[model samples]
Target: MADLSIDFCGIKSPNPFWLASAPPTDKAYNVVRAFEAGWGGVVWKTLGEDPPAVNVSSRYSAHYGKNREVIGFNNIELITDRSLEINLREITQVKKDWPDRAMIVSLMLPCEEAPWAAILPLVEATGADGIELNFGCPHGMPERGMGAAVGQVPEYVQMVTAWCKKHTRLPVIVKLTPNITDVRHPARAALAGGADAVSLINTVNSITHLDLDRMVAYPIVGEASTHGGYCGSAVKPIALNMVAEIARDPMTASLPISGIGGIGNWRDAAEFIALGAGCVQVCTAAMLHGFRIVEEMKDGLSRWMDTQGYADIAAFSRKAVRNTTDWKYLDMNYQVIAHIDQDKCIKCGKCYVACEDTSHQAIARAVDEAGTRRFEVIREECVGCNLCEITCPVDSCITMVPQESGKPYMNWTQDPRNPRAEPAPAAAVVEQAGA
Candidate 1:
């Protein structure tokens, strides 16, 4: 069997799957159940100083597909609402009871040094594994001079991270917000501040939709609604790109990553791990399908590892990082054309309509030798854009086949079409005999 255990930023867990700081990890009740369900760890819901924050009613908005599956979820909910002492007492007892499981407390406070200094010792006394600086909540927290408000500023990120590192012995994983223009700046700042690791991406600022009749957005409280933190499967691509950026950056290449956002299964966890995440966190998935989902995550990942001959998580972690590269570095000589399988086609005409109206008229109606009406690819006009494949309702009916082109590798940096490209050797182009 493959070992699912991981030691992330000096915090050891039975597996890499941990619950991100959210309602799922808000209290001891949820945390205890999650642990019982086989979760390796939980980042306790974000803790602030003395008095807890109050939340509003109907603090959720969701984007759904035609099938009514939630494609994206948004939330305006704030952090822990209970008192500080109560949270601390619960955290301390929970950690003591579940000593084998990793317990990292998430914390957010003012920009000054005093509040952070005051909270670090209290959290450390809980016997928790580490602390995660909650710099990414994009909703109500920002208005209070916390959350994304602090994350968007790199200097503050560095300063606050430094303060936590100075005051606490526990390893610090800085949770980052995705609301900023350049994610790398704050990542580098976290590294500069001596952060042990970084977790991302915090929810995005989004308004689900406008209620046409009411002239208000969804998750409306009374007669109004506000933009909340956006998450769920839709944010996976954005989160993956951000994680890859930090992982592949020379400045923060060695920085430990705890991937968060849109992770719903073991495949998602493997993707993050392959892209250089030492561990992965979950929130939306757990919220959508209770904590038991971790069972599949743990089993599926282990089975996948066993099949791939990976003895442990480290065996294949960051395996794909080297392959992720810039668009400028992509080969320009390689070419592919779309091929349609007539036998599997349902005659929906969706692909043909899409190609004829919106795409390059690459697909057309044809009559086969068997007197069957079918859609065929126009090789001469085809651009291999994959738009037809994307529009096709029938899976595997449209495929992109690579053409035989024995041309030498060439990239944008040396392409003749690039006017600003540096002068270099002319690309070797082996043309097809008859086009």
Candidate 2:
């Protein structure tokens, strides 16, 4: 079996799965339960200074699928509503009990250095492994100029990270906000400020749904509502893109990433690791299911790794980063055409409808002698868009088979059709030699 253990920025864990800083890790009870259920670590819910954050009533809403399955979750909830002393005491005892499990405390405070200076020693005294700077909370905390407000600005991210680095010896992991235009800027800022690692993406600002009768948004409070943080399986693509952006950036490439957002299973976790996350953080998954979900996550990841001949997490980590690239670099000469398996076709006409109506009229419909409908792909007209494959209900019924285009590898940048295309390498070399 492949080793699942990871040393994320010097914090060792038996496995790569850690509960994110949310309601799930808000207190000792939840953390202990998660540990007992096989979670390798937990980032205790974000804590503030004395006089804890006041949370609102009806703090959650959900966006559901056709069968009413939760696709996304929204929350207006603030940071830990529990007092500082109680949280600290519980964290101290919990760490003492589960000595092996990673116990990273999440902290949010005013952008001032004094507040950070005062709180660092208290948290470090609790024997927590490290601290995660909660700069990504999008809703309630931002109104106080603490969470996303600070994260949205690169300067503030650097300033507060530097303050924490100055005040504490513990490793600082800056949790980044996804609400920004570009995630790499904040990641670079964290690196510049001396952060050991960075975690993302904090929830996206969203309004899940609205009530038709009352004309109010979801999780309504007295016929009124506001935008909250959106998370869950729906946000995985967004999170993956951000993680890849930071991973591929030259300045922040070496910074460790703790991938968060919409990770619900082993496959999801594996994708994040392949994109260069040192470890992964779970919240909505554990909330919707239970801590026991980690069992399947660990087992599935381990089994898959074994099949791939990977000896450890590092063997496959960041393996996909190099393959991810700009569209301009893609091979325009590479071609593929959809082939429908006659034995497996259900004759649903979904593929034909999808291709003929929205995409290219690549699929042809015919009626046989027996008056049966048949669909076939016109080889010449097919652009290999995969619309037919995507609309097909049956798996493996339509496969896109690559064709030999008989052309050397060429990208858009070197194509003659492009008005601004760069000269071919041979031409450029000849021009340079003549010059």
Candidate 3:
């Protein structure tokens, strides 16, 4: 088996799967169970000054699929409601018991150096491995100017990261907010502040539901609810793009990335690694399933790496990053035309309706001599836009065939009789004279 261990910014773990700062890691008992269940680590919830956080009942709502299985989740839950002293004690105990398992406590407080300076030592005294600045909680804490608000501004991100670096001996991992215009701005700022690593993405704005009978938005109740941060498979693409952008940026390229957002299976983990994430963090999926899910993640990834002939985790990580590029470099002259296999057609009419209403009216409906409605492609009229090919529900019923230049494929663009762009060739005049 390939070795899955990693030393991310001096915090060593058996594997790269760490629970995010959410309900799964809220207490010591939960974390100990997670470690035993094969999770490499847990960010021991979000901690603050001792008054503790107040949470509401029904603090969450879930979106499910056809079988009512959870596909995505939403939360109005706040930070830890336990006393800071209790949290510190739990962190101390958990670290002492499982020294091999990484224990990084996530911290969020007021945006000043004095408050940060005061808290770093207290957290470090627990003998924890590292500290992660919680700059990405989008809903509850943003209104107080600490979560997404702080993350939205690159200056504030720098200021807080610098303060953490100055105050704590532990390596600092800046958790980023996805609510910004560009994720790279704050990521670069974190590196400028001397942060050792960065983790993302905290969640996207979302509306889970609307109450029709009560006429109210969900969770917040009485008053309308604004969008809470969205997490799950749906947000994976967004997170992957942002992670790639940060990883490829010249200013931030060398900085370590802890990829989060929509990571459920080993494939998701592999994608994060390919995009330059050193380790991957998951919350919603792990919580949706159990922590034992990591067992599958570990086994699947190891098997895949072995088959690919990679020696270890680092061998495959960021392998795909080298291939990612911009669109302008793509070959512009390559072209394809759509083809439909009549034998494979189910006559669902999905492609015809989609093409007619939403895209170009390239596909035409006609009555065959047998008095049945039939769909046919007018090769002369078809521009090969591929709307029909994509919308076709049947597999292989529609395909796009590459058209060679000067081929006799009769599309609207190549017709000499049609007057759109290119002028009639002088050879055509000779042909007309000869006629």
* Highest lDDT scorer: 2
The prediction achieving the highest TM-score against the true structure is 2
Residues 45-99, candidate 3, lDDT per residue (tens digit)?
Answer: 8998779989776677766787887776788778899999999998999999999
Worst-scoring 10-residue span by lDDT in model 2: 426-435
Reference-based lDDT, each prediction: 0.92, 0.94, 0.85
Of the candidates numbered 1 and 2, which has the greater TM-score value? 2
Model 1 stretches with alpha carbons more than 4 Å out:
367-372, 423-435
**TM-score of each candidate structure, all chains considered together:** 0.95, 0.97, 0.84
The list of candidate 3 runs beyond 4 A from truth reads 220-226, 336-347, 361-435
Question: CA RMSD for every model?
Answer: 4.1, 3.2, 8.2
Worst 10 residues of 3 by lDDT: 426-435
Better of 2 and 3 by TM-score: 2
Least lDDT summed over 10 consecutive residues: which range in candidate 1? 426-435
Candidate 2 structure quality by residue, lDDT tens digits, 1-435: 899998999999999999999999998999999999999999999999889988888889999999989999999999999999999999999999999999999999998889999999999999999999999999988889999999999999999999999999999999999999999999999999999999999999999999999999999888689999999999999999999999887798899999998999999999999998999999999999999999999999999999999989999998888777767767788999999998999888999999999999999999899988899999999999988998899999999999997987777788889899986685543333222
Error of 1 at 148 (Å): 0.4
Better of 1 and 2 by lDDT: 2
